[model samples]
Target chain A: MPEAAGVSADLSIFALFWQAHWVVKIVMTGLLACSVWVWAIAIEKFLLLQRTRTAMNRFEQAFWSGQSLEELYRSLSSRPNHSMAALFVAAMREWKRSFEGSTRSFAGLQMRIEKVMDVTISREVERLERRLLVLATVGSASPFVGLFGTVWGIMNSFQSIAASKNTSLAVVAPGIAEALFATAIGLVAAIPATIFYNKFSSEVNKQASRLEGFADEFSAILSRQIDERA
Target chain B: MRKALTISAVGHAVLILWGLVTFVVKPLEANTTESLPIDVISDSEFTQITAGMKTAKKVETPKPLVEKIGEQKPVEELTKIEKKPAIQTASAEPMPIPEPKKPEPKPEKAKAEPEKQAEPEKAKPAEAPPPDPALEAMKKAEEQKKVEDQKKVEDQKRKAEEQKKKAEEKKKAEEQKRKEEAQRNAFDPGKIAALLDKQSPRREAATGDTINQTASLGLASGRSATLTQSEIDALRAQIQACWNPPAGAVDGRELIVRVRLQLRQDGSLSVDPAVMNRGGHPQFQIAAEAALRAVRRCQPYRLPIAKYDVWKDVEVTFDPRDMFRG
Candidate 1:
């Protein structure tokens, strides 16, 4: 005679995946999705910030290379520019508009330039930070989701134990291992999302400040031009 | 967004492929009860954790049986037959000399059970017994046959000292216990075993626990071992399952049958079990034959290999009264 046939324990990954409760399966699937989405957002956001930083470098080089302000503005306003170029164009547009009519509105032209630049800087910062909230949400919430899956799996295993009435390690080991797999996947998804979220948020802040510094310098250059024209 | 999804799919595919190649765990007591230190290596250990056959090797294989016996007894007990020096007289109550060879150095690894669990002390006890009957005689006959034959006893003492300095003391203690036990048991042969079990728990604790039986109860050189009460009960039950009491044999005279058995280490009969008191009555012969058949049918008994010496030669009395759990 031999042991009862009910307790056949297999702990392979695929077996674990298929044998787990539906709740745990769904949790694992969702964690995997979070992983994918986090990586995607990280990639797109990284590329976006890199592009803006380079564009700002090019725009700053053109502005300070002894080129005329009007010429720089003309060239940039004609073509789409991000970050520093966009702020320069918005400010120069208001300056150009004031001088167009016989009664040039030089009375509030600096204020208008500052207002437009402020709007452009905020808009550019908003673009650079797109999809980052998703990263933060996934990072913070995924571990808890994984925990839920583990709880559900453990509960399901206990139920099976009660049903079978066998307390052998063979009876319960596979189930517990499968249940813990949900947590494993969850940790995989959560760790990277958290790391990237912290990294991207800091990069976004640095980019915003660079844009602001450029805007301040550009306004100073415009103020000199306004004094010369007046 | 779609390109990100494609890249994510690729990454996931690599992860899953790695997982399929590597990530796994194993369980204890599924097939070999053989699980420990699992990592990213050896997926096969984790792959086939098939269960339910943990104890399947214990079933008996039947064999052709019986040395016929006739008219049986009222009540009988199991008797151990001490051969050669110990076989002085059948009626002279053969109190066992506690065979000197408590341990043999090696057993050429049994096929089904490859137990290498013999600790270092087993070797220590091997050379202690220069007086062992079978395997030591054979080993001595081989090692010192043509050369240094008379120096065999002196060589054994030297070897025993070399292996373990405590061998002399251990042997002295064992001899003292066996002599004391043998002296005490010259009264009754049947009560000796039960008395040994009862008295030993107290007396042997003061003496030592490593009172090993002859280790080579199997095919090769070995040590001694003993069965616990539960294990003895299991062995008895296994035999009883195969036993069929002769239906019409009634009365106190035909109730009991004592069979003297000589079993090899694997639990099969080394020689036909001799029925000690076979009378010329037909009903008694049926009872005796039935006992012999049960003994023959149960082959390769699941006695512990560690305790091989204790059960190597056991006398079982088949009584229709106790349902053979006795």
Candidate 2:
């Protein structure tokens, strides 16, 4: 009388899990995976970018305070953590290699520095960009993937109705609902991936610019040291 | 780093809060499967049977009754012939002696053969003459006559019994009708009016005594508040029935309002402005005022219609806390 027993009319657990067709289940699973992946990238990139920015700031301060190249290399190599400093050491080593073979002139030094700086910029860009393509792929493609699942799910729902000869809302609503969930998950997966991708890329570009600026300044210091030695 | 952590913490908190809200207020009891079954067959079964019969008839040939009868044997033929005579006798008209004579002749023929066979040796040729045939025919006629006469006597008796039964039923119905009519006529309008008038004063006196007793009791109880308990209860019931609290009254607000009033003999209320206390909420003040207005509009209140002293001056408190707290 209080509507406690037969009145419950709960959707069975099997029905809840199997409400979506197999295709929809797959799509939702994929969307869920994508969402998790995006969140991981967002968090990982946040940490990586934070670390790089902090390290770059410290390295720039040390470099500008007139520490010798050898001393700076030794200190930075000991830590082996700063991405910007690593790039600097690589470029400086290459410049030193190119200078070792050449008659050491202003023109040769200038050319070597320019080439080293370009290579360093490219290497730093690569280091900053690890696994970023995956983020972009997820951001750009997840919505369409979710849309595909939704459309496929809806189609299957209609097909089921045709097979069962039932056209009622109860017969068709569950499948459609499951399909729409895929699209909602897709958007959930896409939005943050796109946001973090943009944010990390910008931060990487900022770090690259800082590294390039530091290279030019370091090259000027090197030229001054050479002139003072002469 | 600290700012980022704080922002993340706030974001997680909001997301968790929304998730909890969604869970708590989820549409758990939706009637999604409240639809009729797909394969309803009872209504279709009749149609299907009818259609099946129609198709069977279209495909099958009809059989003749004569052919069906010929399929049965010699015993069935004799039984049918015997039953035909009985049926003819039962239904034959008295005026139509021709049909009855036909069956009587057949019986005579059969009797003659049986008589000849049984009494051959003792038969007197001259004595077994015309009288014998005539006597036998007369006896058969007399037997039929006796059966007809008995049936007539039975019919007459049945008619007489039926008439007696009908007469008794009619008499009973008339008696019942008279009793109902008498009952309807028993309540005289003038007497009823006099009785009602007689009870009114007694009711008023009893009510007045009750009021006086309650008022004295209230005074003696030593808590001589501005209103009596009976009056408070009545006013509370009235206001409770009248007040519809405003929609979306926020949670965690103490929404109690107390209104004191002066009542005239006619049950009209003049709210005591000095005694009206509006608890802190501004909305509570407005709601209390509205409730008071509702009470005034619902006047002249039907207070224990006979008693005035109990409800002469009353204080009513309106508390919306219970209604809106959840």
Candidate 3:
């Protein structure tokens, strides 16, 4: 009857974490935090991108359905909204403000409307991409961080080996296991972050392009309207 | 941001809970403790060594264990037979109560019965059948002789069976004794010394000249004679863990390097370990330096501190042939 004595200590996840050297504990906790943050960012971005795309799609349908631009802008402007609606409201506001001057210099009105849409598009893009750097940083750095923890843990094991003056596998295996766990968690945090970071970033670029496309079409319509008004 | 944080926290919580429920360090299923290569002497054994005496007695096998059960069966059988007659006599009249007393005469009565039976067989017709007259006396005498002859054969058979049982018991006891002596001999210092001596030639073949040098150094202290083969192997394994052998050398296996280093009791090198073997072979110098680096990297070594006297000035040979072959 061997008591799994080759290496065993209530090797539950909690046990390994609890048994690790303090530096390794910190590394594991930090990596877990990074993983959690990555998932949080990914989830929020995923939902935000979906919502924005649906809003853009609905806006495009309404814009093509022969709905009056004035009526649509009036309906959308009252509600605090995002994406295409925000761009439309901003451009219409600038268009309306230009006319409110009584002496409408139609020459700059189209330019102002275009500038406002561009600003709104940029702001919306910034909001979509906010806090994405954390993911990138974690994806790139956590593995190295975990490796550091492992090295520190193995060093501690070696020190213990000398202190105890015993080289039996039993003596250092737990320490090494605990150390390697930090690397494992680090990879756990890193791989998903890396994969999602790539996916979400590409999605963000697609969203930005969609917003720009909407802005371009809206600006063209506004310039045509300005020409007819003049 | 809040939503993401909540989701992340929930995800981490689920992961931790799943890990908590599922992760278990199952010990290796096979027993690793059997005759382990134990490398240290305990404090009690340390005092014995200082006093120039043998260490604590090794654990011995429990002898005659099976024989104890074997020895008991016959007594139980004899008691069963003895109890049956006692029960029969008691049943006839409740007064005999020799259930307790019958064993005292059991031996004497058993011995007395055959002699008494022999005389009565011939004498009974001569003595008791006189009243029945001539015709019946001869016929009764013939009947008594036949019955007595049967009883004699039955008694002889029983005696033979018992003698066989006794011989079996003796053989079992002798086997038990021999086993105990073998166990004792295995623990004998002289036998161990002989076993160690037997290992040195193979060890010398394996490591070249390091073991002999360590052995001579140990003789001066009257401590251990040399690093045991297992200890040498352990050191070999430690150094090899860090060794990076040079590649691209033709027959790289032949470039064995020996490093002679002194260790402090703490298992660290006292000085830079020196490579003892060098040659004109192009790979020799590269392999030698790698060996020296490995020795430096693996230290402080995890040697048993109790045998530091023997291992302090030890030599280690790095043989890369196995690596090349493997």
| Predictions' DockQ, in order | 0.21, 0.04, 0.26
Candidate 3: C-alpha lDDT: 0.75
Query: Residue A119 in candidate 2 has what lDDT?
Result: 83
lDDT of 1 at A29: 87
- lDDT, residue B158, model 2: 100
Best by DockQ: 3
Docking class of 1: incorrect
What lDDT score goes with residue B265 in model 3?
67
Worst ten in a row by lDDT for model 3 chain A: A1-10
lDDT of 1 by residue, B1-326 (tens): 66766777788878888987786655344542533443462332222122223333322321111122323433233332213244333232445667565555444433312343344556656655335457667777767654665586689888877868677778989999999999886887677677564543431111122232221113221111345569878877888889988875544355688886666666666666778776555678888989899988886677776666567677677777676334
What are the per-residue Cα lDDT tens digits for candidate 3 across B1-326?
79878988998899889888878667423323534344487532332221122232322311111111212212243333322422322122334554433224356666866676777487766665223335466779879878987898999999999999999999999999999989877666656666664443431121221122111211223332447689988988888889888876547656888888767766777666878777677779888988889999998888887677678778888777766665
lDDT string, candidate 2, B1-326, tens digits: 34544555566456646755553322234333434445444422322121122223332312111111122222332343321322222221323434433234456677776766576555657455434556678899879878887897899899999999999999999999999999977878777766564443431122111112111211222222224457567667766666676555645265665665555555665332223564676576677766666666666565664345446555566666665542
Clashing pairs in model 2, backbone N/Cα/C closer than 3 A:
none
- Tell me the spans in candidate 3 whose CA falls farther than 4 Å from its real position: A1-8, B28-326
Candidate 3 Cα deviation (angstroms), residue B79? 70
Q: In candidate 1, how many Å is residue B216 off?
A: 18
Candidate 2 structure quality by residue, lDDT tens digits, A144-224 = 999998898889878987986655555566667667767877898899889889989888888888878777777777777
Give the clashing residue pairs of candidate 1, or none. B29-B33, B104-B222, B213-B224, B214-B223, B215-B222, B215-B223, B215-B224, B225-B307
Q: Can you write out model 3's per-residue Cα lDDT over A65-94, one digit (the tens) per residue? A: 999988998899998377888988999888
DockQ, cand. 3: 0.26
